[model samples]
Target: MQTRNGDLSQQNGAESNSSSNHWQSQIAAVTRKLGSLPVQELKLRLPDWRNSLSTSENRLCDLLLAIQCSNSAADIHPKLTQARQEYEKFKFLCQTAQRVLTQNLTHYDLVSIAKISTTVSQPNTHDSAAGRSPALPVALRDRGSFDHFMQMWCIMTKHNVENMPKMGYKLLDLFQLYIQVEELGGLEKVDTEGLWHLVASKMGHVPNSQDATPISHIVKILSGAFVSVLAPFEEFYKERMRRTAAHWNICGPNVTPGTGIVPTEVHCNIANFGVVFGEVNIGLNDWMPEWSPYAKILRLTGMDLDQMQQQGWTDDLIRLITKFKPTIDAWREVLIKFLLEIWQHSQSMTGQHSLQHPCRPTIQFPTSQVPCEVASTIKGAFSIDEMQRAKLVVERLTQDILQTRQYQTCEVPEVQRLQMNYAVVDAHSLAIQFERIASLDYIVFDDQERTKTHLDQIALLKEQHQILQSGQQYYIMSLEEVVTAQQNFRTALGGIKNACVQKVKERQQQVTINFPQPDEFLIRSLLIKKS
Candidate 1:
């Protein structure tokens, strides 16, 4: 009986030992699997896992790393279960952030009407992120941590169109707070009012507080964000220009082969932001002023003409700014992207001499050395029957110069010697100058009903242009003759030269010669203002 009792005890003890080993192996397998998760995934889980496992929040990362790196998994079963719970928390936070960002602020008591009526916040003051009723996550204090928030924001804004205007407003508010909390504006000395005035000027009117839709406010918020992000690039470009100024002067403005302009050689890589200073200038020049809150839009962009002036005069910088004169449609995409950056992501501005590819396509200008003259000529092309006749005369003269082969070879030994010495060129130069003056006739006398004084001026200029054209033809005809009347050729060329110079003076008088403002088409503005 004693032997039998002892056998049963031994058998039970062996069974209990076997069960303990099996449980230990299972715990180790689960811990190994949990440890294998990516650190980012682990971090996400750690926050919630801390809450579930009642672990120290500060040690959450250490605890997770240990569990992941630990050879033994026997003590990790509880932690694995906690991490799974934390994942749910992470997901919940993401969803909550999305809903808050996407929901129309109008639907909630978000911004009081009083707040809308109030003027802009005081300068140098910041709105606390935590001041909002439902405070943003503690993690949101770090801009990088808001990546998930930005992703969610894009998703909601893209998917929910009806809610976009409200979303834009809410995003404006949120970003304003974020900027304030981050003290983004404090990083740079931005000209808030100057930027406001710029947008106001762009809109072709001053900003009015009574303007509906808060579009100006939205623009202002976006502008601030853009200024903050782009300020670095602006500085980088300034410094780059400074560094390369000497090199460019030595090598000429054509730094990159075929890229004639010096500014084109410097590539601004403000990472995925898709905006250039040129575009920003264009936006200020053309697009933003068309918005409702024109004043606020200015404040946001913080772009001052004086600031542009203070950008320091380098030949390349001047060319860069000058190159942006004409209003362009390219900035529409950039403006859209700028708004996206407000809620979508923070932009990175790092200038490079070379990029993988050009950020914007090289702007193709016609092969005119004087683009303004060409552009003005295109603008001044005639529409009237009488004007059309005048245009035909100029076209005929240009064609005659091109087709006449006799003038190509110099006939007289004296002429040949002069041609060899680069003294006596072809009639092409004379014809081009005459054609340029003729092109201005239509521009000067564009209106059918002109003042008597203006009509007299136009007639005089037209007569000079015609006299010049005739003289150019005579000079060309004489050049082809073996017995070229050297006196006649000189007289003809001299008459054409005098007429062109005189016509230029007369045209300047007929139309007020307004020196173009920075980034303005003087002629276009004159037309708009006077027409």
Candidate 2:
């Protein structure tokens, strides 16, 4: 019984050794197969076989090298083919990690490496050997231990991709990579042509090529893989852009160019927005009426006066007279008629004949001397107070008449006849002067006070005449002296009339009359007082 028990123990020990030998033979065969592939072929196939039993072409290559340099499989504890494959996969991951570090890397590249490493390192039931230990050779096992080191390498190389030139790589290469990854059922699926079209659209390039298979075709083929490879980089760039945009306070909804149409997202935050400015109307046919006789007269007079003044008439007084000649002529006729009518009325009040004794003879006294007793008795028939009152009435009446003529009605034939008969051909000659005065809103009245004082002096002379006549002192003055004084008075009156007309013309020339004002009444009052 003791002999049989020993035999059984020996038989079991032989079986255990045979099982280990079988594993050793399998491991040796795989190591030989791995070693047979050239380094160039390994490098070329690394990316393709990354998820295979070899982990990647680089890991397989590294494993083959490691196995070739190590002691024989029989001397060391041998592992199963499955164990060898896992070992190869682990070694491939290590080599891939090293390669990844050697090249320029990015955060996305590191992430991919991490994922691939995790997948390779995870143990599977399919990887268990039937007769041998599941653990690999010590040299091969060292590859798995290098995982932490690979991760650190990835971290160190993460910033390298940033150093790449923007246009160094062809845009089409990225497109093809994207398509391949999509076909492999990677993270994302993208339509290659559609993506190209989208990019082309953004760039405003029309996809109207004549070639059946253009460069755009290759771009389409690679689009999916391109997107996959670039997605992380794109995300990284997008994150950077987002941060930059935030820094610039540029967070806002998309807006259409040229239309000023705000998106709903931004519209809600707008407090007050408006576009009140507009182009001014500059259309044809905005000119003043063509048939306006007053406008025509104003144009003619203005042109003529400007021409006259341009002919070296620098004296303000002369320029003033020339500028207002037409208006002064009109006012002179009106004043003469008005004064004649007043004298006729006064003569009738005194029971005197205007044709025989004529009211003109009453005012024919020297401006500087007293009137004789005969003319004084004639003036006494109307008291000095009554004469002054008459003059005031004449002034007010003339003002009303001038204003009524100017604003109440358009130029009719009868009105023109009345104006022409009064000796003025045009009323608009005064428009320029009146316009200049009115524009000031009377603010510059002080500048014109000297002219007003001159007018007051004329008024005082007329008053003195009436006072002398009422005191019966007109006989002391000779007929020749009286005629001379009367002529001087008429010339002074013409000057005053010319001055007023020139002022009106100047005002009209400088300002544009769009609306009426109280100055119109003042102008008419002055006209009436002159008359």
Candidate 3:
């Protein structure tokens, strides 16, 4: 009974094998029939017949293995050619079918077909010059073939527009990840083009139509993603600004503490903001003319204030100007006081007395002869003369003040004493010579004492002249030193101005998006506010 069971099992296995062989033979018959046709006829027949053909990997692998093993050369060449042509035709049909089924198609499918067709068309190790077969393992000798197979796999997996959003999201995530990694290592590690190319290649497919809504959506998504990714950098910049402001004290007024007076804290704050928002306030130039109250005052001053009020003034500037008003008033008072003192000195020196006071001067022009119209016409001339006279007075006063201030401010009393003593010695030497000469004189006879006294007096006079000359030289040297000190102070002030200007320019470049015209009042307001 066991033997009978075993025999029955063997019989069933044999029948199964026979049935598989029968189906294989049927498929081979159909393959050969298609292979025998001309290329054009094959192309026409493929579209209708390819749907019935098996596309399973196992079946394709089986067919390819059989083709490699085939010994009949004449039959194999025709069969291989036919198989290649049919495969290409089928590929085209699949692509067309995909296009019809979906508006969007994935690159994976195209890549897969291209790779598979290339692999199927490639020559096996078995083929030779004389149609002889070489003995080599199908897998071992088919590395290029394997590569083509993988390429086909990639092609078969192509995506459509329906899947594009997902792909785009993936691309954005990939870019973000790369950016984070690059940042961690430093900016040098980032290869922008390489990463962009990789992502773009994966997501660059578009439908053949004018419909751009989908693409636009993708672009918007990308923009949002980029903004999100760069958000951290904003804080970085803010922190940098904070640290810089602290280190440089750039927020404070650009004034030295002791050398001269400077604008108030409010003025400095406004100036610093102007520096910080330089470029951004360019449009403020246009607004200034419309907004600034000081512009009207400037015009009334007849001071060419038109050029001063260009731009960057805003409503907030009123606070700054108000805050700095004390400093401005003080400066004005200093200037006025200096002018009054100069006018008083001029009157004293020129002996030109006025009915008002000894320090004031009066003009002697006849009031009746000159008509008001003529006087108005010549007023500019008289004004010019007055200005020239005032300037002369101021110049002399400046020189005298400088000289007295130098002496008064000197810490070393010995230096002054040396100077006074040098003058006194010179005077004493002159007086002694005169006295000696008066005492020794001869009329008729040649008196040796008189001649000697005269010669001695001449020598004393020469010595006194030398001492006076030396004292003058020393005084000139001291004055030159003082001038140099003043010049250094001026240079330092200039350096400060240049530094402020440079800072302002840099800030302007950073912040200003637009610049107003030169004659706008906004500029004057901004200047005043900043000051």
Candidate 4:
């Protein structure tokens, strides 16, 4: 009896398998027959065959679902492709019908078209959550929003709305998702093409030509805008990364063994030039640990990573991120330690390290204008009239040399050798740095207002520097003239002294000639007196 029961089970299993095969074969035959129909014939005769085609489509969807439920969708991709082609053919027919009616269609006629458009655009369950519109249904919303946000920046009236094109509802959702991600500071992390692929897959949007849907085209358009902001921010982020690596390379374990103390210049460089990255505002004050800028950036990046993982990131991406953990950890640890050391050193030297007056590093100008401008400003501030007068004196002396022709062969050195008593040139260089530091020092990590103010101050400084640099050329030229005049004067004085000495010698020779008989006269007078 047990053997007979086993035999009956085997027989039933074989019959079930045979039935599935027959069903699959029949589905294949229908797909082949549908494929052979000419596009024109289908267009002209679709209405006659619409009911039969609908019936066949319903059967095919049912079978596909069954295959998915049984975990066998992977075994028959060819049949699925044929089924998809037939579905697209139907979509084409609908599109053709819409074109025919569009010119004559009334507002009432548009209602069904709108409904059909909305139905087609609705996202599947897989790509629904992030993209689902909060205000309007997918069918009711303006499709223009997917292409350009500015077009729908305000309340979009019907007049401004474009005619609905063939696009997936999921595609709209993807754009919405892009907007959300941008708002949330995920623009830097967005992989536009990968994101499209992921979202399309989730939304059950298969790319096909016959459907006439510009889903890919829309995504490409959306992606261009999406990545526009990203490129600049990424450049800045990579610049930060490069700086971080450079700092680590310079001051890390490779530092010569005896240099226990980190250099002040190193501390200043990191403090002044290092930028804050991964900045996010969670809208909660005092929620962070000690309010370090680096800490905030680190937290933001970590949170972004968490979001990526939560959004069904692939294993390869996960692995790539995991590989970076050691570097990230090392950087974090090294930075914390270095900043701590700087703080301690400051405290030891100043009795208290004031966060209110944080180390403001020197702000360098893009041009060599800073030093030149500062110098010129210093010169002007100290004694503008005196410098101009001194310049006039040099110019007059230069005119004398040119008019006299004696010093014509002489050339002034590139740099003037004049000894200036005015202390502003030295003070100007220090003052520029001092003022920048003062502005930056007042900017606390949490004060956005102060940070903006600091940036404005830097801009002002740059402007002043440029103005000073322009003024410096005149001052420098004047200085060179003064030095040259002084040199020429010394040369003229030496020449005059030599001429006087020569004249004196000639007078001595004349005196010697006149006094040649003086000794004989003295002898004659002495002899007469003795007689």
Across 101-123, the per-residue lDDT of candidate 1 in tens digits comes to 22222112212211111111112
Query: What is the Cα-based lDDT of residue 301 in candidate 4?
Result: 40
Distance from true location, Cα of 79 in model 3, Å: 74
The estimated TM-scores of all candidates read 0.22, 0.14, 0.16, 0.18
* Per-residue lDDT value at 318 in model 2: 45
**lDDT at residue 482 of model 3 (Cα atoms):** 32
Backbone clash pairs for candidate 1 read 195-298, 196-298, 196-299, 202-289, 203-289, 216-293, 223-300, 224-300
lDDT per residue (tens digit) for residues 135-169 in model 3: 22122234454333222222222222232224333
lDDT for 152 in candidate 2 is 22
Error of 3 at 157 (Å): 99
What is the C-alpha local distance difference test score of candidate 1? 0.35
The prediction achieving the highest lDDT against the true structure is 4
Poorest 10 consecutive residues by lDDT, candidate 1: 346-355
Q: How many residue pairs clash in each candidate?
A: 8, 39, 29, 1
- For candidate 4, lDDT tens digit of each residue in 420-494? 211123223323343332222222123434333333333333333332333221122233433343333233323
| Predicted candidate 2 versus true structure: per-residue lDDT over 1-531, tens digit per residue | 999999999999999999999988975675555445555564556555555544444454555565777776553333334456676666654444323322222223323322222222222112222322222112113434333222222222222233322222433323333223333332232242244544434333334567434546544444543444355543433343344333223233343321212355432111111110000001101223332222222233345655645645346634554544544344234334434444443333221232222111221222222223223333333335744654454455435444543212223243233222111101111211222222121222333343333333333334333323232211222333334444443343334334434444565655332222333322343333111
Best by TM-score: 1
TM-score preference between candidates 2 and 3, better one? 3
Cα displacement (Å) at residue 235, model 2: 2.6
